[model samples]
Target: MKQALLILGFVLFTLPAFAAAPEKSGKSKAHGNRYQAGFTLESPEEEAEPPEDNGRGVEIPTLVVPVFEDGRLLNYVFVSVRLQVADGVDPWKVRGRTHYVRDAMIRAAHKQSLGADGNGRALDREKAAKVWMATANETLGGESITGIHFLTVDSRS
Candidate 1:
């Protein structure tokens, strides 16, 4: 019959697709059935670590401070900083006390302005870096960090 021929044609066309598929190297020996997926849940070979806290240094939350001039409210500058760990200091210890460092830096930044030096429209990187480094060092009670590096400094009016 035509219906039987059509079914035979459909099976002939689809059979090669299942036969051509590579077999899964699972423990199950029942590879005869293509519909059987005897897969077991397997854990990943290794875990991934956070990008910033990979024993290099600690990244503080971005600091958003107001840039003011002559009692006028100017644009806010967002400062992102990273503290490099000292050679002998444990990075985890410094990382654990990061909140203190951030608080001290925020207080210092509130006291000091990070406005432009001579350009009058950009942040003074030199002065800002010094303030951040000094505050972090003082807060950690020793030279817990080698230095403070500015990651980003931008302003929006």
Candidate 2:
């Protein structure tokens, strides 16, 4: 191990290209600065631009729903959802009503199969989104939410 490490150190640090000091020979043009402490010209730093106005969104807690085949329990699929709010609708207001959304989702999951193809497969996203949309609008008393994004649908057996 010591021999191997010594050989590695020799190959790495002793290479003229990898040398940390200014080159004695004029071969320093190929490899840019390899020196740790030596002063070198750095590329210009990029200025951070302000973010564009994307509309609001609300996140709901993940819910676990059972997956079954032929009326027997197989495993659980964890569903995470995020609601995209319509323009002029407050996301925090939707966030405050997330419990209602979460409750409705859980109840709907119990009442119906949200999975597309069972056995560790993805959920039926369109169907699930429909349920979320209808439930959120009904609970919030308006169509405040424009979109339902299924963040994740992981099946565990």
Report the poorest 10 consecutive residues by lDDT, candidate 2: 38-47
TM-score of each: 0.61, 0.59
Error of 1 at 122 (Å): 2.1
Candidate 1 per-residue lDDT, tens place, 31-134, comes to: 46544333222122222222354466789988876666766655567777778888888888888888888888888877867777554435676787788888
State the lDDT of candidate 2 residue by residue for 19-38, as single tens digits: 65675887656776554432
Candidate 1 regions with alpha-carbon error over 4 angstroms: 1-54
The TM-score of predicted model 2 comes to 0.59
